[model samples]
Target: MTKYSSEFKVKLVNEYFDGQISILGLSKKYGMPSKSPIYRWVHEAEANGLNYLITKKSHKEYSQDFKLSVIEYHKLHEISRLDTAIYFKISPSQVNSWIYRYNHYGVIGLRRRPRGRRPLMAKKKKKQTRLNPTKEEKYKQEILDLKAKLHDAEMDRDILKALKTLRENDPNSKKQN
Candidate 1:
């Protein structure tokens, strides 16, 4: 129910890393309902620290053979996602996703796919509306659409919250005072 700033989360994770306190200790000290978030933050901070020095390019394509090998190695040794990713020089989430795909869809799932925006995303292949709109304009329009959707979702959330409050405050429907 409560959201802490990134700075605050990083501060606590750093303290844990510095041996000033444990995850449970930090959670208890801060009166948090659970220690899981602190643990997650610590892991995230560690991962970021590990990647800080590397100049590795993001979103590199991997061969099907390499993906299969990574998945096989992971299963053969029963290694954690983080450990497998460390061994293969890929992000942990990517390794997990590839494994999930392979498990559900077999080898075909591991085949590389195009990354980034597809040239044709719209359902209709209508002619260009504007006179050769730039790629930046297309991206900006997508961003604006997403923002509007987010705004609408937030309004729905607020309306639901208000309704819940009204229900809680309603009288003569259940136990009387």
Candidate 2:
């Protein structure tokens, strides 16, 4: 896929919004084969806070479990794709695509499939690689994250309780309600 500069996308999107030309006209003016790419770019800019789309690509492999875990984390926390992508060290668009794939294909969609010729033998595994967190460590980290979330929820509940008490005690607040 051809990578377009973020500035180029924003310029076209601004032009589209400026009402200077129709979508079809913009496409033709830019030597685009169709209007859809421009439309897609503008839509993405609006949706994702602009600029960052698919950036430079380099080959990287993620484990199926890791992919599913990232999606699961997203579903559980309801975090934004941009945040999730940052936490996962991937592009936001990639996380968005994963969500789409998971919705359509389930867990099977996340499994890594090699595109072409296979190696004669699997590459020798490295010891204590920085990338792979052990299962126990992952579980512990998840537990800690959940605990923090729970603490925040409890604090919110306490604050709400205090506010309710205060409102009940205040004759002025009751009148406002």
Model 2 Cα lDDT, one tens digit per residue, 13-67: 8898899898899988888888876876666656665544445568688876687
Question: Could you estimate the TM-score for every candidate?
Answer: 0.47, 0.40
TM-score winner: 1
Pairs with backbone N, CA or C atoms under 3 Å apart (clashes), candidate 1: none
TM-score of 1: 0.47
Taking the tens digit of each residue's C-alpha lDDT, what string does model 1 give over 1-177? 227765677678778878978899999999999997777566655765633323344647788668867876786666787767766666677888998986765565666676788776778888765244356535544554565567678889999999888888888555866
lDDT (Cα) of model 2: 0.72
Give the clashing pairs for model 2: none
